[model samples]
Target chain A: MPTMQPLMLPPLVIETQNLTKAFGQQKALDGVNLQVVPGAIGLLGPNGAGKSTLIKCLLQLQPITSGSARLLGREVGSEGREIRKRVGYTPEQDCHIPGMVGCEYVTYCAQLCGLPFQAARQRAHEMLDFVGMGQERYRKIESYSTGMRQRLKLAQAMVHDPEIIFLDEPTNGLDPKGQAQILDLVNSLWKRYGITVVLSSHLLHDVDRICEQIIIIARGRVLVHDTLENLKARRRGAAEVVLSGRHQEFESACLRRNWACEPLPNGHIKVEHHSDSLNSLLGLLDEIKLPPLEIIPSPNALEETFVQALEISHATA
Target chain B: MPLHDTSYQHWEGVHLGLWRRRWVIARAGLRACLQGKWMRHLIVLCWVSALGMTTVLFLVGQLLVANSIVVKWMGNFNPALQAFAGMLTTWLEQHPEISVRTTQDVLFYYFCIGLMRAGIFALGMAIPLLITRDLASNAIIIYSSKAVSRGDYLLGKFITAFVLIFLTWLGPVCAAWFVGNLLAPDWRFFWHSRVAVAHVLVFGAASMTVLSLLALGVSAISSKEKSTAAVWFMWWIFGGVLAPIAVQTQPWLRHLSFNFDLDQLALAVFRPAHDLTIAQTNIPILGDMLRGVRPQTLASLATPELQGAVAALLVMLALAAFLIRNRVRPE
Candidate 1:
């Protein structure tokens, strides 16, 4: 019999069991069982990959065809309003009331989340300032730039002081600097304020910058769900070693030493770090009389893994 | 210079109840409506009619009181005071029925007419701005994503429109009443005319509800303010034009006029004894044309006319509610 490990973290903020959602003949989410631990979790997927669908189902904004979901330990459909009271959402689309200044719009949103008028107004100002909106906060939302509008959306999401925030493509239309600022803001929400953030985005770099844990969904299924640190750590010790000369002799020497090696078209040999260390590899190279030019660790293995997961899922589907 | 803290902070404050939260939308909408220069100008213009009606009441009260005072002062009056007293007595005698109609009752009648007109204009100007703009901008999603429910949002919008119509309609009437009371000779007039106040309150509430429902329903279905306003205008014009023609071609269709139904309902609520079958004897301009041709005369007050008015109102209200409910969801 196998024994279970002792629990270390708090209960999950979101838990779904066989969550299925269908639209007519098309299945948007299929038997997705997800347990999201509290903190910053990235929902990574391509368009139409059920990322938004899952979020909507979990939020009770969309009804599931079958199965159940819970948010903050409360069942989704039955306790959606209760869940919404404690959760904030920034949608991917442009959602704004026309003829309203930024401060009033944020205040109105905060009020909609059950904040008192005075408190909502105060928090709206605070949130706008936090999002780097200054005197422009008094300008009509229709007059705001794309970056300003993005910041305003973020500010409204935070104005109610929700425990968890669902940010869908927060950095979607931003410039590089704007994207960096938004990612930093997302990070600070989890780090400084301890707010759980479920950031859904197709941008891997944005997720990589802010998310501690990632959930990659493809074809209505969760392909990968693990910590970024663990995913990156798994690729460690694997390296590509290049030789200036005697490449065939070096490749044969690596195989004779019982090391797995494959020669690339770029004259670099892909070497797996098994029992042998770099010293052993160097010794083997010396025996072949080939000088090592460069030994670079394989980069962006997570990206490769993501691509592999997508490809495998597509092939299986 | 000290750097402003741009860091995220936890909200330590408490939250209000759901209804209070819902009021936030209404308050914001009301503020936005009041902020518009066009809306402000329209409101001012509407109140100007109220002010004119109040001035008429004030003059009527002054004329009534002048007769008694002038009679008492006739024994020791200069030629100017005598001359003024004779003119006032002649005017008082000429319009003796005006005094018979209590100041409150007259004000109520004027208010009902004023409010109906103002309500139409306010609904046309404000509802589109309030609802269609939000729809066009896709702001309903932002609202739905928050703690506010669809029903709460719709109710908040209804309240905003109701309050605006109330201000334009009842606000002026109440002001006129206050002014009339101040200008009256004694508290007897107010005490005797308390029922008119009740009629005003009830009529205002009913009219406001119907108009708000209809405006909001139309607003919900439209994506653009201009489109909503245009549709509402066309609805009125079509109804007005169609109802009269239908009534002229087929007398049975007299009750189909939206304006006719509303007029009958207003009469039933505010002046139940006034028979629409007879030509209206008062009012100088449209009285001759309105006399026998009024749509309500086609059916007796106890028969289909009043029933049709009530039924039409109910059907309109139900239709508006249905449209509003369907369109208020997250898109």
Candidate 2:
């Protein structure tokens, strides 16, 4: 038995150095150099943007054609076994060992991570409970619905209590309520449990709901990776404000505050919301007594960011 | 934004490492294979056939004992065993080790044959159950993403099928050996037949390893469960039908086309010091009564030599190893 070594995890959960994965002439992950800190990270990319490929490469499920990567401070390929022990991954496709029930499957996965059988069983049930699986947990995975299977996949991934969980398209094929339920559960992993969650999806709304960090990939390259606040802040001067007072007064008030405010034809002032937060703008309104009737931050700011990132990446390519 | 604490929390719990973890896959694989109705039935059927074959061999072994009564009774029919028994008893009394070896070799030969036949069906079922099913469900991703390396996964899968294959042969072979020794004239029977089990242990280990490799290789390359089964079944049918016909045209076909090679291996491993009269016919009065060519069991004189068969099997092992190694890649 190898003696357990105390972990010295790096500040970055994932760090890739010029990582490139190619199939013959086509590169799936082209010169991807990234340093990902731990948090709820949304990996957003178009179809064939190498989101799945990147996840697989980081997990070492797929061998990297070249370059290098590290997960949780352990070098990939060399320390893959130890890395895998602490990381949980679910690919986009549905997968389960046939004939095993949900609990058994999860327990089996836990055992594979080197947990003893009894502990594995206990942890399996714990994860199943955490995933909100009910009596149907006893049912074979083959008979599970898409939502149930998705939940089961998450349960199995977490059964080992991994430090990092990578979920690719986890919310794919779920209804709105099911999606919210899964998203809430996933949110808790990052929020309450503090497990690093790397959620890869095309659903901008899903990412916008929970992710603190956003990575947008296009043309097999990362166009942008920044804090969600920073990404949304890029759409500066897009916040709309409606005041109960006169429009001229608000415009004068905004001018006095030196905020980048634009008056649209619809009688609303667009303020840049300095520092990417509306709290300061509201404080200014309170001080000026230009009582605001409404404050509408750009709801599509992340969407625009995602689109513009892809466009820029394509343009550069 | 606050950066993470960056303190990796290694588990302080009991954890099984590489050496202890593979059994999980093997156990799960076994559960799945045994859960299938047809798989269970096929194993049961194999055991039943083996039991019957063992019973026949036991009865035949007894009839060959160098005693006077049976031979005296059959004297009028031929008087061959009576004279043969006189020389056999004299030779056996001088070199009793041959008698012991003869007893062990015949039973060991039948055990290998039964095991190979049963293993073919088990492989047909097992490849689909263990290998392609994992592929079809994309369970490979789940496994590959876990702590399991390709070698661990392959070993786990091999153990599952090998266990089933040996179970089909070992149980009946031991039963025959035990019962034969029980009814033997003295305690020397146990000493004499102790080597019988050795042949089975070595043969079972070697052949099953190759067969397990073949199963995994076929399963890895195939995309669907049905296709995996079809490939194995096709191999069985292809070799079964072709080997006989190929035997006529190509003398070397025995080494490559069919299972004459396996039989050749069995014959080589279990060759007795001297071919007993009863070993030829396996029946008391039949050695003289059947006055004809060699028994069907030994009729493969034109079959290629043992070296040829061994080279063919080695080639097969290499090919299977190549397929499995290439296909089970995480890439």
Candidate 3:
């Protein structure tokens, strides 16, 4: 028997194949297959979506059920320490040592990551600075705000300068500004330091802004895992363009031009076309000179896509 | 491979992390013990209680040893004093190494024994408090990084607790011995009293091992507040005033009491000042044994050795590892 050799190069720095986790009678993660590339990959899911479960399985903090995960060419379960050494993790919950100074806590974490004392200290200082926590580095963690505490957690995670970092809802309890600051720090860490980030969050906007690829999961199963482009492609069938001209004229003109256009009740024409024909609309506007005040491509309904995935997951379940 | 990294902390063994974690936690516990007014007050109360009990016991023992007319006269009216004196006198005669007189001797014998016994109890009591604090405050994860194994983390905590227990017992023992010697002048008899005191200390340390383990087990099983309640309730059931009563009321129940065996062991080990007519028993199989044999007795019976300490330490470290493994359920 002859087997065909594989063709597509795997983009993932970390990938899971039929990964599953169960807690007694309850299954926490059920047959999850996730491939995370070298850029920011968002792990989005609802409360029981198994985002945390997947992350924990990857870290080997929780045991896997049936399948396996690969991180940086190594299997997650058996090579967790090796994976963890190269990958940082900021837990969803606020884990703070009240009496220890921020620097002390980070330094200890660095040491645990196998850095020597002087080097750990140096790296800890650099990490604090990287997270914009330099001024408050000497202060005890008990005095830190929720934002500062979150930043401290982030700093400790990166103190060893890991190759990949897992941030589980890093902005979970933070204010908007705090969230922005943290996201900014996360973005910089990825952009400047070349750290691959697996940011797990329920907030779609956060995922939309930072992630090049998104995996939306619900109820312990993956609903979708694709590039943002693929997701937009998935939504292309219902594409609409709003026009601010005489609806009748625009409709007739579009019909004559063989463009699928429908007139709305509010004197706005909804022009429908394949994503490939978006260029044709622009070209039509230039030729016809039916200059409307605005020609806006309606934003792709991501919230709808999310709800649709949920519906699909629910129906399939 | 670079033999010399030219940096701090060249080694990467679990001990390196365990040592630092142990130091930090021990310092934190010591600081808490010293700084908090309530803790300081608690320590004061402990010292006061131990001192009061020791002084009373000493006075009563002295009265019995002297066989004073006042004591006899008192005994005529109250048979309680007569019985107590007679019992003490008998107790002293079996092993006479407990009551040292010279400044050095008294301090060595009484202080060491007092400190070891009282301090062990106090320190053992304090351990649950520290564990509960860490659990309650949710700060335990701060010092315990995911970088180290759970075994290493628990070993660190156990090491810290052990060191704290040692300090608690040692300090009191030194103080008690110093005070005992100051009150008395005869050095030879005092020296003889030292052996019993030393044995009591070893017994106290042995007791502490069990107490700390039980405390940790309780802490691992319950929330901090519940853990505190469990520790106190277990202590009352096993160690405090009710234990003796239960032992006395039901003769068979005496075998189950930790304190009963501990007290017996202490008495046997610390053969008081007037003790003489030594008796030794050697069993063919298990050697000369003390009163009760419970599950902990096997461990208690083993002759104290470096090898035994290492084995006990491994068992403790293993138990701690098991506790941590089951503590956190996947969310």
Candidate 4:
């Protein structure tokens, strides 16, 4: 994960301030503020998390209820056409002209992206090759595999050579190999071209692999938005430290030492401390004369952090 | 970077890119219609059925040698055939030498109907599928490239629909003209009449243009499946086998019919002595129905002329184009 850095400029390609969307009485997005930098950023959320709603408003693909979005320094709805020219989008749902060949389909996209005829054709070929679909370039899209179609979708988004691309669940139905291939393609885009990517996925592992920054949303609100490292760092106190021999006495001592200590179900002392270092915790145990049978450091689990955030946000609501 | 001028130039480039996208769609649609196995079969079937209908009519005519039997069977079996033959023969009696030209002309008229039906149906059936396929396969990634805007995408689709309709009708009309000339050498006399040929061109351009725009309008309003179903259902109901039945049941509605418009307008133009019976009955009644009064002069119906049809077609196309913009939304 990249360290959170302060830049002279905003360092954001996309910014949404107090964004909200409602359908009649039902609110789909509620005061969601997101700032995305000029690289791969993952959008993680469960179903009905307002991820789709956010994407729609950002692209001006649908009308928003309130708030605002800016892409490439222009307001969303007013400058949607201009914003679209600088951004490529691969929708979660397939949009294809069934009988059109891959080559023809890509070329059409290239043209819509403003390449002239000869250039469109050449770019289409190059795009297909980049997606590893060169062999199937002339084959009709209706006959393509799910993975191939996904790749083609990505290719079309990239063919116009947009500065930024939004890939909405690009690996939704792919096998492991296919998913990896898509991930590699996405990674390569950022590395080779410095293209900003906003990848939406429900899979944490996938997001963790490609995204340095992430925005996790739930039920139409931003739950958390920060670098992955910062998110993990927030879970520091949530970590567990186990001491087997200490038992009840060690737990009481740790509680007195200003550590949140609990007697474990396994009859050990489990400690959680945000401010104290590992050495301080060890010194406290030594000062208490509680020699441990076994010592273990629990994993810094993000899943728990995510659930806790959701629970806290929901309870407050 | 110079912001103002360069930004405008970039935007223009994107708009042009959208037009390029439309050309891709048009080419794909044409290729699909021309090559798809089912579409090819459908076209072949239309040609065979039309020729078969003509052959059956000729054979039946040959079988009925006696005038009494022909008259009795015509009155009982098919009223349209009977009325058409009676009108033609009554005209033939006044100008017997011209009967051959009239006969060939009638055949050409029927051939044009079959041609228009086949062309319109085929083109209409394909358009919605094009829209649907794009949505289904997630192929719109190409359309959303930095070069394309939503408005440009809509325009591209409009062009595709218009061109498809044009070519579909053009192909069959040319074929029918060629075949009609070969079957009846007397058709040359009819073609020699500059007025006759001019009328044919006007009618052909008007009716087909109307049908094409209607197809596009339906495509814009509905999804691929719904668009296809709606167009075919309407075609079958309004222009196909049920058309005559509808006319028979509702004589008042006959004036609104495509057949009625063509027949009345043609009579008002030619006014051949042989067509006195039709000129008096079918033509005048249809004219009255359309104009809502007895014909003061044929010049009234003829005044606005085929130009009205052309204008109507252009308007429908523009409306369809506008509707298509709303229909195609971003993800």
Candidate 5:
């Protein structure tokens, strides 16, 4: 093993101080401040919410407009080369060198990460194996299917066995099974391989299942940044019941029972759980004889938290 | 559990220096270029050209020596000897003023120019495969995402295309020089020809650097491979073949052609060492003979001035560098 340089492997994965990026009059990253640690972090945002821009800024792939940023304790632009040595980035687009076979392309990427030729080739093969790619590795990347290309991108990103990897929409255009397989590999990157991952996407289901930390950005500003557990724990006693358009009776019953309820847009009623247990809502459901079709309890849901964060950001704007 | 207790992976290998990574880019580029059928065929053609070119130099070196073995061999009455002699005589046919007193330095200049004519094709084929394909495929993201910098990427690509162009010309020139020197009469022959070899090196470096970068610049600006190839070929072919037609009228229009400018530079580089007398002028008499124009003296050719050649090439090189610098970044 090579001697580990402390500067190369800092404890904090990313630290940005009021980092801003602008194109002419419009700012893509509006004075964003963040300190990311090692974990499976989901960067969630709606379309055009600066998720990709933030990743690009953090990697120094684009010039910052103002302020400063660092990766693994090194300054963003000045030390970008060193920072990239310990980091991997799988871009949201299909990026493969033309006229190269899958294995050769991966080997080239490993070499670019500073491995010697033989070592790079061996590492590339090992990474491809780890990503569950097989004989298809010998084929040209131009001929690869979407799933195969995604796997190739993943393999190339992990070729050097980076400490952290930024996956930008890694599951885009993949079938459900392929998406599941990729997510499984991504989960393993953090679990079995112990590599930090920053998964940037708008898909809440994917994030909810794989990410421990969530950073939600909307309109170029961070709406929320906290642990998924903490965000979910912040939820109050609440239950959203599918009342099947019979909100008036449920509203009357909830009013008599001293429980506040809001009728949702999708024909559901969100009831504030004042009772110590869910049996209160259950007992009320039995008394009203309006028997709900489905009841969803909060205080452990990411969807509610995600929606609330987006709503607050929208309201602020 | 955020992956059941987050920890750094165990493989904490040392990152090599930045130069090594740049070399990696260059090495990969060279491998990719060589994969093309045109590149492979061009390499084989260069080899064949080198063999043919050096064989002439070998005979010339033998001629420069006293008591030459080939001259002695030609005296044989064997049927094979007569046929070989006939071929040599036909090839060695030259003007009365040029045949007996040709110097090695002037010959080296012609040799360099000859190989360059072939090299234009090599450049046309190899350069499009470099930056154009990368841009077309959107692989700039792949490179930018790595530890390699934008400068490193361009330099790596420059080296790859430069080597391809060099192999097609300078590499063969060096081979011809070495083979010729090895057949020389003695150490004095090597000393006598040192100036010519130096001229070839200087000429080779200048031309290859300018042409390779110019082709790369064309590649950088355009994303489509076929259009890039077309643009490069048109620039060289039109400039080389058609520009000479206008040279008869304007004469100075030779500056518009990179090949003409480089050839003029080649003449200047060899001028100091040429052994031609004031009564004679350097002329590839057969070139004019084939063109159906009666052979004329160098004084009548009206070539582009050396200073103009130098300035034009410098401007061209700057433009190429600027294009590559701007377009090498991720879009």
Candidate 6:
């Protein structure tokens, strides 16, 4: 391992302070502040949500209008080469070299990241194999299928064995099976190899399946930044209870107990469990003489959170 | 549980420095260029001229040695061969100036022709394959995403073109020079002509730099190889054909042709000493025919040919660099 200089001390794997990017009068990234620790982090946003722009800015592929970003403890703009040596990026676009085979393309990428020729070649094969590209590795990139191209892209990004890999839409165009396979591969990248992954995608399920931490961005700003567990935990203890009889009486009884309640048209009442225990709610239901049919706890799904965040962001604008 | 062991293995190998990364790009590009059949054929053709020149030198050396067998054989030739031999002797005698005084002069001539042929090949074939293909595919993003910068990528492509031109230009000249020395009577010819070797190096280096920059600049602006190749041929062919016509009507238009400008530069760089006069009579008929189309009367031009060539080459290099700098970006 290379020695880390003391002057470059930063514990976070990715940190940005008030990062802003603008083109003429329009700003693409506005006062974005992010501090990410090393793990499987997900960047989720709708189209034109600045996810790709943020990744580019952090990679130093594009200059930021203002503010600063550091990756793996090195500043982005000034030390882009040094930072890139330790970080890998798979761009969203189809950026394959013409007339190069899969192995050759990956080997060239590894060489570009400062690996010697022999080492790069060896690593390229290993990465190709790991990506499940078998005999097809010898085929020219232009001849590969869409799935193979995505796999090849992943292989090239990981060929150097960098500390972290930024995957932008790794499953952009794929069937369900291919998507599942790629997601599985991404999950293993972190779980088995100890490599940190930052998966940027609009697919909530993909991020939910792979990333432990999530950052949702909307309209060039980060709407929410928290762990998936925490976000879901905040929405816990809320339940929708169905009634068999006396729905109005049950709603009145819940209101008297200071529980927030709203009766639905389907004879189900939504209630926030503010009391100490569910037993109390059971006792209150019994006292109301309303037969409880069913009760289901409603934890906030990542999809709902993403949508709500976008709505709030739009409303603010 | 995971479906498969898509594990990431740690790379325990040593990491190399960025100093030689540009060579990696150049090597890959060179390999890609050599893979094409047309480029390979052109490369082979580049050496054909050198071989022809070397054969001529060998025959001249034999004639100078007064070998009895060659003379006897010439005396017994058919009418056509006898007529050619008699004409050659008459031409040689009429122009006492038409003599290879030293092997250096022959090597310099071969090197100039070799460089020109190689420049054309590189501009037409190698530059398009190496640069335009990458741009057409938007592969610059992949290259720049790694530790390599945009400048490094451009420099790498430049080196690719430079190496191809070197092989096409200098490689043949060196081979011809070796043969010329070996065919000479003794080491005296080699010793006297040694300075020409440095001249070849300087001339080859300057020409390759200018041509590589110009080709790469044109490649940078255009995305498709075919479009770039068309633009390149149009510039060279039209400039060569039209500039002469324009210069005939307006003598001041001589500097308009890049080919003429490069030729002027070559003349200035390879200008022989005043005592070593050229043997024009000994040159083949084809050489004499081609000279009529080439720009003549370097001294009569409004500006010094050498200065105009240098200024034009520098301007081309600057334009190429500017276009490349603007085009090679991730955005």
Give one clash count per candidate, in the order shown.
0, 1, 22, 15, 0, 0
Candidate 1 Cα errors over 4 Å, as ranges: A1-8, A230-298, B62-107, B251-257, B272-304
User: What tens digits encode model 2's per-residue C-alpha lDDT throughout A84-202?
Assistant: 99999877898888878889899999999999999888788777777778788899899999999999999888888889999999999999999999999889888888899999999
TM-scores of chain B alone in all candidate structures, in the order given: 0.79, 0.77, 0.53, 0.53, 0.81, 0.79
Clashing pairs in 1: none
Per-residue lDDT of model 3, residues A177-261, tens digit only: 8899889878766676677888999998888778777888888898888877677666663345455555566666678876687
Best model number under TM-score:
5
Q: Score chain A of each prediction against the true chain A by TM-score and list the results.
A: 0.82, 0.83, 0.82, 0.78, 0.82, 0.81
Badly placed stretches (over 4 Å) of model 2 are: A1-10, A240-299, B1-12, B45-95, B254-258, B272-304, B329-331
Spell out the clash pairs found in candidate 6: none
lDDT at position B284, candidate 2 = 35
Ranking of all predicted structures according to DockQ, beginning with the best and ending with the worst:
1, 6, 2, 5, 4, 3
Tens digit of per-residue lDDT, candidate 5, span B123-220: 77876678999998889989999988888888888888788878788998888778776775444556656777888899889888888778789889
- The TM-score values for the models, in the order shown, are 0.83, 0.84, 0.68, 0.66, 0.84, 0.83
Candidate 2: which docking quality band? acceptable
lDDT of 3 by residue, B104-166 (tens): 232333544455455445554555555555665555553333555445455555555565555
lDDT of each: 0.77, 0.77, 0.62, 0.63, 0.79, 0.78
The Cα error of candidate 4 at residue B80, in Å, is 38
By DockQ, who's the top model here? 1
Worst ten in a row by lDDT for model 1 chain B: B275-284
Off by over 4 Å in 4: A1-7, A134-139, A237-305, B1-18, B37-114, B124-128, B135-151, B170-209, B217-234, B237-243, B246-249, B252-331
Off by over 4 Å in 6: A1-10, A239-298, B1-6, B62-103, B250-256, B272-304
Score chain A of model 2 by TM-score against the reference chain A.
Answer: 0.83
After superposing candidate 5 on the true structure, give the runs of residues whose Cα lies further than 4 Å from its correct spot: A1-10, A239-271, A274-301, B1-10, B76-102, B248-253, B272-274, B278-296, B300-304
Winner by lDDT between candidate 4 and candidate 1? 1
- What DockQ class does candidate 4 belong to? incorrect
